[model samples]
Target: MRLDKFLKVSRIIKRRALAKEVADQGRILINDRVAKSSTDVRVNDKIEIKFGNKTLIVRVERLMDTTKRDDAELMYSIIEEKYERDFKNE
Candidate 1:
């Protein structure tokens, strides 16, 4: 599956266009490398998404053209989440 479509079908980014936009901005990585919207995704692939100061990493478990809301979570498994804290305000 395409990276953008996988993000949407897995209910990660909510929309395909947004996924593409994020990918274009170089905020999404596949296997530790920057990935484009058309990048191919397969099982066991690691996807990392950068959201401002927070980052989310997930591993693709399976692929499907369509899935129910309840089954979306089964598509990928959250591996790690990290947040960059600003200490200047402290």
Candidate 2:
């Protein structure tokens, strides 16, 4: 699945267009490398998203063309969530 579609289907970003915009702005990383909206997403791939001061890291657990809201969270396993400002205090 495409990165944008995966993000939308998985409910990570809530919308495909926003996901594409985010990816185009270089706010997304796959396996530690920058990724575009059309990037292929496969199982076990690590996805890191930068949201302002917050960073979300998740591993793709599965992929489906469409899923219900209740099942969306099953697609990815959140590995870490960190806030840049929080870490700055350390």
Worst 10 residues of 1 by lDDT: 81-90
Give the TM-score comparing model 1 with the true structure, all chains together. 0.95
CA deviation > 4 Å runs, candidate 1: none
TM-score of each: 0.95, 0.93
**Top TM-score model:** 1
- The Cα local distance difference test for each model comes to 0.97, 0.97
Q: Work out candidate 1's RMSD over C-alphas.
A: 0.8
Tell me the lDDT of model 1 at 4.
97
- Error (Å) of candidate 2 at residue 87 is 10
TM-score quality measure for candidate 2: 0.93
Q: How many residue pairs clash (N, CA or C atoms closer than 3 angstroms) in each of the candidate models, in the order given?
A: 0, 0
lDDT per residue for candidate 1 within 2-89, as digits (tens), equals: 9999999999999999999999999999999999999999999999999989999999999999999999999999999999998988
